[model samples]
Target: MPGVVWIALAIVVTIALVLGLGASRLRTLSRRVGSFSCNARASGQDAWTAGIAQYAVGRIEWWRCWSLSPRPARTWYREQLELVGREPFDDDGPGHYLVRCRYEGLDFELDLAAGDYFGLASWLEAAPPGRRDLVL
Candidate 1:
């Protein structure tokens, strides 16, 4: 029916607008660090969810890649974060390595590509002098 068609069109338009706005917001607010993908599990949560991390002025903002939300799901401040450990990814996926980090006494895992790994390492190392202390 004509009403059904109109409703479908409206739904499609709404979805498109949400996606466009989300992408625009992400690009305007943050810069791409590299081809980075991560699955993070909060300290108390047992499940891990996939997301992407963007470098902000003094912190890293992580957003769920599948969601259209404009706000970051988690923000890890540079000064309060420490690298715990790292290991090569076991699966043959795009991610090359897995990094474990502690922020504000909570642990988080980030999976990065080779380039993203270097970029993250550089970002941490380039923090203002005495801002971060390397654990290893």
Candidate 2:
């Protein structure tokens, strides 16, 4: 029927518009620190999955590349993060290096290009000096 066709077209257009708006809002809210491509393995999982990480304030927001949601899949706070080790790229892969880190009792591996590697390392290491409290 004509009415059914019109309703289907309207639904498709609405879905496209909503996805476009969500992507635009995500881009506007997050600042791109550097190029990132990575795989994450949860504590119990034996396999790795694709993810992307972006730095925001004092946290690293990790998002699943296949997801359309604007929210971060995982957020690693700076205060509870620790760098464990790094592995250099073995071949001509897209990732230049892989940095492993532990945050909030979970471990995550982040892959970065040469340029991004330095930025990520510096961001993690640039903690301010400790402040002492004065006795009243």
Candidate 3:
């Protein structure tokens, strides 16, 4: 093989390896308890970015699917998150719901599967009695 051909092969192999590793890591993370696939969009924006949401005590952490960083890209505290609205999401496909929420006064939306949406609702509703907002 020519020198150029060798270099091209090496580059392609490296790219494939990186993508494979990233995907494998994502699959592993998604299999963990309380983790679900979701897409998020900042309020007023039309783009939805793929990610995984993990429910942690007192908070929800989201990690972008394509990122290699061990830290979550975004975090919403149970105390700060307020559910604004929810509706069907047609942009992505069926069985997806768009949840509009406000955290610390900033609005954002999470696109989730029906099951995941129910899970999120349950998690929020299961907050400690002391943490629940009492309208009285």
Off by over 4 Å in 3: 1-3, 134-136
Candidate number achieving the greatest TM-score relative to the actual structure: 3
Question: In candidate 3, what residue range of length 10 has the lowest lDDT sum?
Answer: 127-136
**What is the Cα root-mean-square deviation between model 2 and the actual structure?**
6.3
Ranked candidates, highest TM-score first = 3, 1, 2
**What does candidate 1's lDDT look like per residue over 39-115, in tens digits?**
67654565668777877898878888667676888887888878788788755376477778898887877767777
Residue 88 displacement in candidate 2 (angstroms): 1.6
| lDDT for predicted candidate 3 compared with the true structure | 0.86
Question: In model 1, how large is the Cα lDDT of residue 57?
Answer: 90
Candidate 1: list runs displaced more than 4 Å.
1-5, 19-36, 43-48, 92-95
lDDT of each: 0.74, 0.68, 0.86
Q: What are the clashing pairs of model 1?
A: none
Q: Ten residues in a row with the worst lDDT in model 1? A: 28-37
Cα deviation of 79, candidate 1, in Å? 0.8
For model 3, residues 1-136, the per-residue Cα lDDT tens digits are 5999999999999999999889887997799898999899999997889999999988999999988888899998887787788999877689888899888989899999989988888888788787555110
RMSD of each: 3.5, 6.3, 2.6
